[model samples]
Target: MSSDAPVDARAPGQKTFFGHPRALSTLFLTEMWERFSFYGMRAILVLYLTASVAEDGLGISESTANAVYGTYNAMVYLMALPGGWVADRLLGARRSVLWGGVVIAAGHYVMAIPARWSVFAGMTLIVLGTGLLKPNISTMVGGLYDRDSPRRDAGFSIFYMGINLGAFIAPLITGFLGEKVNWHLGFGAAAIGMTFGVLQYVLGRRNLGDTGDRPADPLLGADRRRALTRIGVAVLVLLLVLAVLAVADLFTVNTVVNSLTIATVVITIGYFARIITDREISSTERSRMKAYLWLFVFAAAFWLIYDQAGSVLNLFAADRTDRDVLGFTFPASWLQSVNPILIIIGAPLAALLWLRLGHRVSTPVKFAVGLVLNGLSFVLMAAAAQAAVGGDLVSPWWLVAVYAIQVAGELSLSPVGLSATTKLAPVKYASQMMGLWFLATAVGDAVGGQVARLAETWPEPTYFLAFGLASVALGLGAVMFTRHISRLMAGIH
Candidate 1:
């Protein structure tokens, strides 16, 4: 392996214990606290919106709250395109992350103010802040390791654990404070968490060194300019369309659907145009890119189900669950902790299981397993939903079980798909390729909100059943196409 890009500026012959670098610790803590704030606030958002006006909530209708929740979450991921571009092109990842953290902290503090306007402003800032922070941070994590280092996967798994750890604890603490006392207090707590994250990242600068330093190569400049131009033009067109819709009073469901449809068409055309115009890409590389695009479609299905934990599941717990355990009733918001808790417990074991099953199982096979497991989790939830019909409460254990199974699926797919992205992406367009990957996630989150709103009209069992069956079918389809994808991934190993 080449030593061209040294992650940590350590002296020669210095030992890294447990096959990982020291800087991992700093990044770990930084991400942990960041996720702590994000998830903590997320756990309470929908519940706070839908709570009675007498309880100090805005008393927004359930569907509207879900729409806002979904749109906010979607925009958070969508903004990463610009965030990643800015970091890779001009600001560098380290500075972008720091600025992002500051913005996020400010956003949370805005939410802490006791006013509706403040809440809206805070959410807007948070969405933009997350766009800046989230993708850049992950890129920094990758920068911490040398390319082709065997420890890369292990390091990412460890980083993923840090994410879940914060997620696990945030809701428990924040939910308690919000439900038992004041909602603003919970938001304030999240602000404090982000503040700590910012402090830690700032203090640990030496550990990061120049890993996210700007590229010295001149060729990157042209790439950056082209990407920016494309994005700017797209945004301008979108804004104009939205402006026209607003003026015409067409900013309704049909308008949203049309906007999304047009966005999809534009993205499709843009990708194909890149393939035609870029002479650097080989036929084989183009084939691999096509496969990756398909994987993005599959991933959208997975997130459409998984991202509902904050919106629909939170509401389900508040309205339907028997929250009492032992003698005391737990806050409904705390149910958001279930998936993270399961991730914390199940991730390492799942990694070990995959390693043991390695050689016997292909990556595509594992992906299929993940999809099936995710579907089964929804099936289990569907059963629970049926049992809980007619306003009767169901056992909390059912929710726990569902989350556990879903986490199992997440463990199988999330890390693996990230690894696969680098393997399959064309080297020249890597950042944009990753942007598309995140765009799929954004679409899924937005759709998840729409799916959750269906519960208002349809039986919960029907919603779960439909999601479960679609996931399973998608998984099976991926399995059937495994050979083609494997061929695309030929050089990765």
Candidate 2:
């Protein structure tokens, strides 16, 4: 279940499917299709970029491609800030999600064109569309049940499962189209998925009632006009700046990556400072804030390690690892599906473990465990590297094993971490903490790209071993300091 699923949006005495609200079906399908489109496009993006020009690709260097990939991923999370604001103050969640899907479909169609500018324009539109859609869509799922309803968590769990179902299937369909037929076809498939999602949501809108028909905090008429005008001006300025950069060739790979890296660090530090200095919070809350700062650190490290499943790890599957089975070679993009598959299988078991052992296990302890598991995945990658060093193709199980362990770490860290943030959040800063969580993810992706680029500097075994050990050391350090962080958490588990 998504811990971020808002409790305030509950529906009462509502009709249900299987004891949960009937509206969940529509919302679930919408999210499922949206994720399918998003992950489907993502599954093939970097591969298309790095493929040779002869193969209808841009033929960019690996380092540059990694930087672009990282920057794009980071932008998605960062954009959520403005996205949520826009939904709350201007367009209600319904309109935002509806238009977001339309924009996304248009983006995909743009990508289907053969021009390089189409790729850039398509990705930009998708990012903008996701910003509008991603933050607002699942919010309605939270509103599907009454506040006191016991089924709310179950509904969110089912909703979460639906999203992952699409994630698991995306690579199979899009990856096959991208790797076998045409990359543009893969993008087109994503567009088709979004179109279906939009249609479903439209048909099912009546079930939603007035859940997101109006903004929670409505703006006055003049203020609304002013806000919209400012928004338009900001967007126009941004476009003009981007156009200038592209025309001048100032949109270099390093410039993009370095800018995001700096932005992440500065914003992260500023958020920490704001929390620590806030006078309205209690001393204990401040202590917990300090502790979450540390959590933020490990969170970044964990994502830095985990996100490689799509970057360096994907490349490894394509190059070093053997994909052949009885002369039918597997598509490299198919490997992108493994983590989501494991998460779908593992999340419930982990949730149960936490329920059974919530008090016995501390938040810091879980973080430590998650960190260690992520570290161990890289260690397995190192082992894989060693096996393939002699120029023999390694077993596909090597990459599969790494993804399995990493998914375990994700199960421990991701959802659990979200829950912990909500519980530990200061009264005035609850939403801010959620944004901070997104910021950590943004930082992780930006830094992860730079780290992936360094794979070129060292031999495979050394590269894997070095980062792997760093993670293990961090995990052990987190374990050793568990009691201290527990103290700082002020009784939060």
Candidate 3:
């Protein structure tokens, strides 16, 4: 078992990273730079899509851009399912992370090439690479400590800080370059960041020891061959489908985005159905999974409204927010930094608040709180939109306020959901349960992308008000069902 692996992959006299394993430093830095690249690119994606072709932008409609953004996010999360499987069965976490980083760096470099087709091509590669890297890195981090070690939680907390730190810094650098200089130059910066992460990861492999040196559950000869064949067929089928679409003149962005959206929905429904109907799981486990279904819905709904930060909200910042600071206008993407910065500042505070509340608050109640706060943020956005009427630009503080509220909501729900997934997961499907959690986000982002088309068609205030109230109503409904969901949790806190 991985628990038996060396926690400190260093000579006895060697230094440690803040008294934890030296390996923590390696994984931490890898994750940080990876996040830097990811968020840096995301900060400017929609802006680039909607900018004039004369200005070296894609010239896509805002609605199409939003859908593209949503679909892109959906795919990134969705790939984690197979990504984990590959780590467990084929490449092992170490190789998977290494290759994933290589692919990710390549993707960013491709995006830096300034060709129209390169953006989409690069995004596809990035999604595939991210899927492989993201989940496995966390797994390796977990391998560092025993299951019940107190240091395990502290280690993850430190790792979480790395994520937010990278996110906080990315937009400042990339936004300036992309908005002020060339969009491709900004993407090139992201490429450089990932390349740094990859190089350092390789150099720091000595610290990793044998943490993820081999597969958790490696497939053997015949089975491995079958799996590889299946993967090959899947890829072939996908390419063939694209070829057919192009030949039929139906390979438009909208067509592909809509199709992927529908597929996400179907995959989610099928995933749930397969698990719930499984003969291997016990009745008690089935009941718990049933409760998880509700949580999944709540999580999906929460992300639907929350993830709009990059698309609808980013556009609002660009077009409707007054960015003038003593006649120097800041890039709209700079606002993307607000969420991570707030999270970094508020995460500890939220942890303390939850510690004080303890079991009295209940998971469902906390989720309800998250939903309400998320909705309230959007409700405030409606007011901001109203203020921007008559071709007037509102203060940038409006967005800062919105992101602050959303961060509060995120701090309340995200960590709690991850904890709950681990607690409520069926023993037989433990790892896959994490995949299901990621799917909840995928479903939300995919659907939210389709929903965002309304932002372009409807009045901004009405659009914000309707969705805001809907989330509030869902939160209230969650409040009403708390006791029932609690019972279904079957003693899980």
Candidate 4:
């Protein structure tokens, strides 16, 4: 999504291999395999961290594991800004993606070696690699289709399907091995998955053509030196901060988690303030940006609810949900796949439904619907949690239903929000605005992690119900403001 490339409907000469562009296929499969590694590692990270050392895990506390998960996920998105900057200034998306792939595979493999030092080191590498890969690759995908091309939305959907395909299968394989066989095996599987993505990417680089080969604004000699120096300074400062924190006995899980949460929020506010006050945009553009700011709010809320799948709900599935289906127990990591599987099945149908009725469905209305659906999912989970308060395991269907509802919610908010983001972004700061959109996710995920950390402290029913009610209330509030937000959108729908 980090792209400021001008829309060109110029016929892609010699590029009509998929009823659109051959590059879309290459990008799609690369991202699919990339996501396979990502989601595969994610599916078991918290579980591995919190499991007993006897089980080949780190034996961290549940709260610590959840916090680490939250912070890791948060950094993954927050780094996209600098990663996109690197591409826009020096590396270009293709090289960034390639290097990112290398780092990602290395990270997974490191974690596969099974040691105390490897855990944090591997996570840091994945975070950096993901930061480099995610936004730029998404920008490349957007670059593949012209703005006016009808295939643009469809292309993203197809691309998204590839992502889900990876997500859907990753857990079935990695989850089984990680949870049942060995955690290191699962991590290694994730590495292998990324290896496939990298090999395929190299083979198909020609298909990518010159889409993300050049910078929108190339840096001059002085600018290049200053940028590199700044990166070095930033790295030094970060190391110093870590050293200070260690000296103070404050380099703990909560410190890192809370600091990141604050950082995400501050960055979000700064981005919105900058975009809204920019003189380069027209009044209409400014107003649309403001509307986007609201979308950011709703989006953060949605993700805060959604991201619990990896932390709170993951733990629930492991300990609280009955996976015994006719005496055949399934791995808890398999629970992560249910959402992507549903998304794979439901995304196309949702796309079709939107194509048929998009004219009538306002963006805010879609966001409102998404919020309501999200709340409903938590409501279902809350009921299950209530039923299980007496030390009974809830039926697995409760989780399935939660994921199914969330799939609907995610379909509405995520895709619509992505389109709305690019549409509403100020042209001068388009890539940064994309980074801002993901900042909302960073905030949500960080906050969700904090909430998950508290899960053990609160009664299951109360925790679920409180968050569920909050979501429903926010949804209703958005519905009430739909017309106002639409007016501010300045002709974008």
Q: For candidate 1, list the clashing residue pairs, or say none.
A: none
- Compared with the true structure, all predictions reach lDDT values of 0.79, 0.84, 0.94, 0.87
The CA root-mean-square deviation of candidate 1, after full C-alpha superposition on the true structure, stands at: 3.6
Residues 1-493 of candidate 4 have per-residue lDDT tens digits of 4343423334555555457578777888899999999999999999999899898888888877887888788889988988898888888888889999999999999999978878788988999999889888888887876667787877777787888899888989999999989999999999999999999999998777677877656687999999889989999999999999999999976787788888888887887888789898889889998899899999989998898898889999999988888888999989899999898889878888888996698999899999999998888888999898878988888899999999999998898898788889877877677888889889888878887777778888888888988998999999999889999998898
List the candidate 1 regions with Cα displacement exceeding 4 Å: 1-22, 213-269, 272-279, 488-493
Model 3 residue 298 lDDT score: 95
- The better-scoring model by lDDT among 2 and 4 is 4
lDDT of 2 by residue, 156-252 (tens): 8998998899999999999999888988999899989989999999999877767766665667799989998998998899889778988999987
1-493 in candidate 3: lDDT tens per residue?
4522857534578678888899999999999999999999999999999999999999999999999999999999999999999999998999999999999999999999989999999999999999999999999999888777878999999999999999999999999999999999999999999999999999999888789999989999999999999999999999999999999999999999999999999999999999999999988888889989999999999999999999999999999989999989999999999999999999999999999999999999889999999999999999999999899999999999999999999989999999999999999999899999999999999999999999999999999999999999999999999999999899998
Residue pairs clashing, model 3? none
Whose TM-score is higher: candidate 3's or candidate 4's?
Answer: 3
lDDT score, residue 432, model 3?
Answer: 91
- List CA RMSD, all candidates: 3.6, 3.1, 1.2, 2.8
For model 1, state the Cα shift of residue 115 in Å: 1.7
Single out the weakest 10-residue window by summed lDDT for candidate 2. Answer: 1-10
Please list the residue runs of candidate 2 whose C-alpha ends up more than 4 Å from where it truly belongs after superposition.
1-15, 243-248
Model 3 segments more than 4 A misplaced: 1-4, 9-11
Give the Å error, residue 196, model 4: 1.4
- Against the true structure, candidate 1 reaches a TM-score of 0.88
The candidate scoring highest on lDDT is 3
Better candidate by lDDT, 1 or 4: 4
User: What is the TM-score of each predicted model, taking all chains together?
Assistant: 0.88, 0.94, 0.99, 0.94
Best by TM-score: 3
